[model samples]
Target: MSRNRTRFLKEFPKAISDENAAVFIGAGVSVGAGYPSWKELLREIGDELGVKSDDVYDLAALAQWSVSDTGGATRIRQVIRDQIAVDHDIPAPLNILARMPIRHLWTTNYDRLIERALLAIRRPCSVISAQGDLALKVTAGAARVYKMHGTVDQLDEIVISTDDYELFRSRRGAFLPLLQAHLSSFSMLFLGLSFTDPNLRHVLSLIRESFTDAPPAHFAIVRPPQKGDFRSAEEFEARLAQHNLWAKDLQRYGLFAIEIEDYDEVPGLLAEVERRVARNRVWISGSWPLDEATTPEVSFVHDVAERVGGVVGSSGLTLVSGSGLLVGSGSMSGFLSSLQKTGAWDLERRLIVRPFPQPIEGGEPDRAQWDLLRAELARLAGHVVFIGGLKAEAGALVDSSGVHAERAIAQAKGAYLLPIGATGGAAATIAAELIGSDLRFDGPDALRPSDEQLASLGDASVGAAELANRVLKILKSRML
Candidate 1:
């Protein structure tokens, strides 16, 4: 079946519905955060031992043989820890996961990145390490970080080498139950892994054998236009069909592959993910903040929004000053002039005002008006606030806005309320509050407004003076 926006969004809700969702990550996730891939790490080890990258396979085999002759697994552990001191924290991906809402994490790699991330988030969690403690406890009801493979800190616990792998294979009874429970209930979002890893292949085989009747669905992200060893999109769909995995080509919706061209890009990508997770709770009302405006009143709304751009969130409650905010230009002009004269004068922190236009007797939102409004909203920056009442008839202006706003706030994302009461005045008030709180120009340590700033925003007409006053009020409030 073809996967589209509807299907993905629908599935996404299900995937994230559980606060204790299971997450199976692979080395690729770390690689995106700038850590070396398994192949790259192996090559690095080979190079350190005076061997070429292509000679990695043979050299690894030789190393394994040497270890076998000298107590095998124990000696190999010493080789990795002493001779190869892999920088465990040099490039950490835990920072990325720390921002996500996911609690449960399972990985085959022996790295401590996930544990580090969990600790950073300050969430109580249990780390299952083969070397340190196999004492699995479910009573805490807290998230668990199961390191199916051993970690670097313990030599005897390492899961490398053919013999060690075999031992784990035979000892599957220890961890299989937990894995099965997680797999059966949670929708898995696999990262930095593919169908190629032998360990993954074996895990999939075991899963297939365990749940022969009706296996849980699986999902994996693959870079588009499948390269080298990656299964083609069509082939992946067929492979997943065997284990009930329904593959979706993320590229169709602008996120097919990790798409990391350089190491520097990883940080930015991780930051974006952090921002999205944080923003996921915010919801906007009023003018959609992104919608276009039609009249000078609507234009005023857009102007306010543009100025208050810094504060508007994607999932926060955004009440647009709707029909209730629109009034005669004479009343608006007075409010604007009052604001301009009384508010602070900081040009650096812009204040946006969205105009709410009264429809011409029988008219709806005009095309030209919407186009102008959209352009204005697009120009918003710094902080955004809404006033007046626009959708009062639907009651959505109150209900939906509150739900979304609270959700955003719970996420530690910011949202402001202007109480859809005072036409453009509320917008000005909200802007003032944010400015007062802004550390940039507060206290004896505040930014002084320049003369040009006062002159440019002096007039009060067509929403210009009101916006200027809003800016001034923010600056003045913060100074106190």
Candidate 2:
């Protein structure tokens, strides 16, 4: 990955965690979902006026001309509704954005793509198209979608013509104030935008003029101009220069541009952001001897759970665990109690349990059912940690859970896995397998394990704090 991408991956998570992240969607995003751009909509309007759309680059001006020629905005409204409005399935990028924990979304689009995408993901969103909608309180944790230009569903309120642009300051009422507040407060990520709309540019300029100090940093994902779209290499280079210049000028409004090689990269970048934002959720699976509480094996489980609890609780990460007696009951239960003592444990908010709806009733769930539940938990977690177990039923459960976690992590495409061999049981077996497969090893030592260390692991003599620290280290490394 490029340096800009790395920086974005690092900073975006922090922004989401702090509830200070917002998104700005542009016409290009809608276009990807088979909708027309402003120019395309204007082109159709130009055709009605006996003017070639390609000849008119100023879409707002073209819209004004159409409204004046027809003596009203009736034709303009019809054109937008006819050309831009649709009920197509939401695009992948929009779907990812909808599922993210972002609190606010600003869009200059007239279509309902953003709202549709959010609805598809079952994410509650309060749509703001007019000033009256601003007074309504949004549900807690629901995203607020600010349709700055107006939605196609309400043609009369849509901002398209140059006259609308000129009067936008006065007509928008509380919209501009709310937008300005978000700009000053949140870290905004602008997607699929060309930064060419005059009305939006003007509003941005006004915001910049009002700020004496540096404003909060914002970002835009821009594609470098393609050579295939130009007549010659020289023409392409000139276009690239102009694009670069426009991107640099946007810095005046505190919007830094992260240039991608092409539009195809956008979805991948957005998906990565979603993954990182979800990284706060972690899952743990393992088992130890439940019969003897004073045994080193059982003691290891309690000690490690306590230390891991502190890390998860303090870091504000959610913990997901199964309901198994030794693995889930011993580890997660202890962790929850520790967090409760610190006043950081909220069962509804900070914890998630798998196997709640028992796959089988009247008896112990079958092995396949347990595996399925563990897989589901692993799929939801950004990291999975395994601790201890022997060849008995408890150890068998631990081994199966570890295998399920590994498969789920693979299916997820990316997730951190920590198997502490020092804690013994299923964890030791998994660690040995990883070493043998050359998937992971202890530093530069390769598969060479000291006999004494291996013996200590089997004997469960490793300190719980040491095992917990190692797990935390692996989890942190994956985040970076």
RMSD of 2: 4.4
Best by TM-score: 2
Q: Best candidate, lDDT-wise?
A: 2
For candidate 2, the 10 contiguous residues with the lowest summed lDDT are: 444-453
TM-score for candidate 1, please give it: 0.49
lDDT for model 1 comes to 0.44
Global lDDT of each model?
A: 0.44, 0.70
251-293: candidate 1 lDDT, tens digit per residue: 2212223333344554554444343332222112233221223
- Could you give the C-alpha RMSD of every candidate to the true structure, in order shown? 17.8, 4.4
Tens-digit lDDT track for model 2 on 1-480?
255566777787668756789998887787778887666768878888889876776778899999899999998898888887778668888888877668799888888988988888678888999777888888886888999889988889988889998888788867876777888888888888875554557656656854548677787888878888778999889878888888888777777778898778888888777667657777666665445566765766666755675566655677777755666665576567667777864666567788444455457647676656666576566666666654346334345444445445533545555556666666677656654353433442122233433333434455776656555654554542
Tell me how candidate 2 scores on lDDT. Answer: 0.70
